[model samples]
Target: MTLAASRQSIPDDIWAKMQGRSWHSDRGCLPRKNLVFVTLPYLNFSGATVEGHLIVHLDVADDVMIIFTEIHQSGKFRIEKMSLVDDYDGDDDKSMFDNNTSAYNCRLTRGGATMSSHGRGIAIDINPVQNPWVKGSETAPANGVNYNTPDKRDAAFRRGAHGIVMPDDVVVASFARKGWKWGGVFTTRKDYQHFSEDGM
Candidate 1:
């Protein structure tokens, strides 16, 4: 679906709050099962897009509202949920070349070298258990394989049927249509739930 359509899925009140603040007119949107996500526009070293996206899940909309209210009460503005996994990698003092995956292995590593997108707060991995990073070395297990081993994940990567339950894919497609790239499409590793403004 187009970005505009995704944007329309955003709750009116949430949209109003996001407008002119955390989100700008240039940002794009994606609609998922009971959620509307707004993606930021930024690029990564792998030519992947990275940006902040507001994820509002219908089931957790109330929780989001509470978080926003709490932030506002504390005099904070433009609040966005920064994943803890992202924070840990940013604070590490080890050699910058370490192949650290942080929370999601969205980062690329060559030998001992490491790369990350969480430092910019542009990419997000949602409900990681449902969407896992299957390594090339091991045969994918059945329980965690949502549709079929790699087929389901592959379909999701291509923006097909298997992506329906993944809110991130919707966000990815929204970004892709706008010239952004999803981490799932990367040649080195497939980050099934990663969506960024840069082309990975």
Candidate 2:
């Protein structure tokens, strides 16, 4: 879908949700500026709309375009839910890592020194189960610990076969075009599901 159509696709109620200038203490990740809810043409593996809050920035819109285009091009079909992780079980990574899509959760960084990009509304996680976070020997979703390989041969990480987004996928280029960075390219740890304005 084109960018204009994507913008038009958003309904009034959904747009309403995007409004308001109040802080959600429960979901502390709301950005202090340029915060708005954007309903992208993204779909879950089952074909549901992949809409969520994003910073009011061009990069965020472009990133949505990439996800929308990549899925349409891949011709893959499967069952899944793309949701804000915080909505599922607060900030729990274990519960959020199972094939969910989310952005803007108010929370400290993984190491706790500072707020994460998500907390700033500039980062997102797509299909966390397929693109599990790998830190040393630990994986966010303990069940996905064995599916760490970037190789598409693994059913969990398979591209068109199972809806996984790999490093080489067009989705990466999509975000890259907007100056957004992919966590899959992180040097210290691999957060395959993550993408952000600063590559956090």
Candidate 3:
């Protein structure tokens, strides 16, 4: 089925939930009209089919659907959950803790002034618990640091662990084919849960 069948402008009710949480008109975010809600079909670790959602820039919405469709067909990987940032009220921490894969949150990098790729809806975070964001001694999702270890990381590629994304995995490959960059390759800090247009 063509995924284009599902993308749409944000409804007023949905926008209300995202107002202060994920989108702020006062901030330098793109206009809501430039964003689209797209459906992503994927598989669970057990190979069960699941439908997901994302709010992304219109330019990348189709790309996101294509990438997820590729990964879903491969059946070589899985995601814990996939939804918009507003699902958790734009709480990145709670989303990570709950392992919610998502895109489009009009926030900055590490809550700083620098806009994140996510702010532009050009980035997506998947399975944050299994693939945490790491910087120095810090790791996101509170309990995911151990996955940074070689042994644990190997489990991801080997499919010994669900929701963990490996560099060579279909999840990464699908996005890569669309010119997105995986955050797992970051030199200073590895953010295995991240994938974006610019690789940041």
Please give, for residues 53-158, the per-residue lDDT of candidate 2 as tens digits: 3333334655665555555455443325654343454454743555666775556788776877876767877767767788887887665655676653255543
Ranking by lDDT: 3, 2, 1
Query: Can you list the residue pairs that collide in candidate 2?
Result: 28-106, 29-106
Cα lDDT tens digits, model 3, 1-200, are: 43322678988888888988899878888898899988777877676787888898999888887888888877778887787778888888988888889889988898467999999889999988888988887889887876875577886557577877876778888898999999898898888999999888
The model with the greater TM-score, 2 or 3, is 3
Choose 1 or 2, whichever is better by lDDT: 2
Tens-place lDDT per residue, model 1, 115-166, is 4443223444433333444556431222335632356655754653322224
lDDT of each: 0.37, 0.59, 0.84
The Cα error of candidate 3 at residue 53, in Å, is 0.6
Ranking by TM-score: 3, 2, 1
- The C-alpha stretches of model 2 lying farther than 4 A from their native spots are 1-33, 47-79, 151-160
Q: Which ten residues in a row have the lowest lDDT in candidate 3?
A: 1-10
